[model samples]
Target: MYDLHCHLLPAIDDGPADLETSLEMARMAVADGITTVACTPHIYPGVYENTAYGIRAAIRAFQCELDQRGIALRLVEGADVHLAPDLIEGIQAGRIPTIAGSRYLLLEPPHHVAPPRFEETVFDLMVAGLVPVITHPERLSWIETHFDLFERLAMRGAWMQITAGALTGRFGKRVKYWSERFVGDGMCMIIATDAHHPRRRPPCLMEAREAAGALVGGEEATNQVVIRPRGIVNDVPPSDLPAAALRTCPRDQRNANGPIRASVFGRLLGRKTGV
Candidate 1:
């Protein structure tokens, strides 16, 4: 499996604090079944200004460590870019790091609300010929509130990625519901760990798979979601879902502010229940 989002770089952001921790996280990832991980530190305007060159250097250094340790996991470059107006300009100037240097960019939106400039950002990415693979839309306020917005973005050719923890109910019940619903409806194209550490935010997608299996009544659909995400990073197309099988959250269920009430309930309940 491939962990599309992670803070594995030493002291870059809210990830590992040192090289040893980074290595330990990598080892844990492989042990938990992740083979490739994108070192996506925050790259919005103010949070973490991780440039492509710096990100590459980090990946190279991490790769060297992996090689020295004889670890088989591959380290790739990506940016968990925060949503900001200037981001589009950065991408055009080659300041933002694409996933594996592919056209796909891992975009991170604001935590509490969807920025009004989101559509414009997508337009900017399109203008620069970059395919924006939205990272962890399940956590975004926009998707939580306005489910149709996702369909609109998908219509605009942007792909969606859900965090592995969200699938396993690690993010609470609302996230699980969103993740499962999106995967089941074919609204989601990839499932990544988005891991940050060995324990606090460990790397694992088993819970996501379990949830997918339960929802889809089989493993094929769930596996398809997990496999295609890595394929996108590797420049492979995802398995196309049949029109009839695809689903969208009911209009009434979507949130205009952020997550729907069900999601809030699920999350609250999940927190209360704990993992």
Candidate 2:
């Protein structure tokens, strides 16, 4: 499998602190069935402060380490870019790194609160000809109340990537619940491991894929974890990618008023569960 989001670079951000830990993480990923991993270190300006050039250099060094260790995992360049006012300027100046230098960018929203003009900023990035792949929205607190915002973003050509751990209840029951809901409702397009270490938040997705397969069927679950991710890394357009057989809840199982809620093991197939 190809993991499109991971923090495997050493001393770059909140990932591994040294090369040894990074190498260990790489081995863990390979054992977990991840052949390719995008080294998406955080690019928060005042915090991580990772520039495109620096990220590229870091990826090169890490790749060499993997090669020397005889690890089969491949590292690609990317940034978990925090939303900012100067985002467009940063992209224009080539200071922001996209996934594998493709048009796909891993855009990370604030976890505590939704930023002001969030929709406008996403649209502006789209207008600038960049595909903003929203990372881990199921973990966002405001999504429970403003879930429609995500549907709108999808209509505007944005892609949503849910963390693999979120599906296995690693973040919490709430995040896991929403992750399943989003996948069933067809809002989420990819699953990635936002892995930070070898043990805690480790690089793994097979278990999550099995969990997702129970809802969307084995085939569609594979599309989320493998097919779409490969397309994003290769800069493939959404129309050209494979379609997911979205499963919906039975009519009697749906809620009457707002969103349709699915049981923990039940399918919420094609129905539109409102925000």
Candidate 3:
């Protein structure tokens, strides 16, 4: 499996603080059946302040360490980039790195207030020939009201990356509901670990992959975790991949109060409640 979004680099933002922790995260990721992970740490100005040059240096050093330790996982370059007025310039200047140096970039929106001209900004990115893979929209607190925005973005050629843990109930019922909704409605393009640690935000996608298979199908789930991610890392354009297949979620077909076990995740994850 290829995890396109991960925060495993040491001392580079909210990822593992040290090399030991980072290595442990790698081992955990490998155990979870992940072979390559794009080390995408946060790149918010005045906070993470991570740049393309710095991220490359970290990847080179980290790769050497992994080789010394005999870890087989491969590291790639990316950044969880926040929206900026000069983002297009930054990307054009090579100050920002895309996914594995692909045209796809992990675009993180504000968690609280909706940013000004968000859609326009994203369209600008697409105009610049950069694909913005919106990260963790299910976990966004405002998704309940702005749910239609996701669908609109998808229709306009943007892609959404729903977090893996959100489907496994690691985040709460609210997030799980949206996660299922996005998958059921075919608004999400991929499911990534967005993993930061071995335990807290552990590097695991096998469970979510299974859950997605149950929601969509085995083949489509494979596209999300393996085929499509590989294409992104290899710089394959989005138009080259299969179109997202939309399907009604069984929960909505049944009822809102219906048990989730017979529907999206509870049945797959061995849970007891709905939502």
**Root-mean-square deviation of each candidate, in angstroms?**
9.0, 5.3, 7.0
lDDT, residue 194, candidate 1: 78
Candidate 1 TM-score over all chains jointly: 0.81
Candidate 2 ranges with C-alpha deviation above 4 Å:
248-275
For residue 104, give model 1's deviation from the true position in Å. Answer: 0.5
What's model 3's TM-score?
A: 0.90
Candidate 2, residues 194-254: lDDT per residue as tens digits? 9998888899999989988877667768988899889988998877986444554565764
lDDT of 1 by residue, 176-268 (tens): 788877766556666777778778898776666566655543433454344565566776533242211233235575456522222222332
lDDT per residue (tens digit) for residues 108-182 in model 3:
999987777899999999999988999999999888888877777877889999899999999999999999888
Would you estimate the TM-scores of all the predictions?
0.81, 0.89, 0.90
Ranking by TM-score: 3, 2, 1
Query: Candidate 1: what lDDT?
Result: 0.71
lDDT of all predictions, in order shown? 0.71, 0.85, 0.86
How much is the lDDT of residue 43 in candidate 3? 89
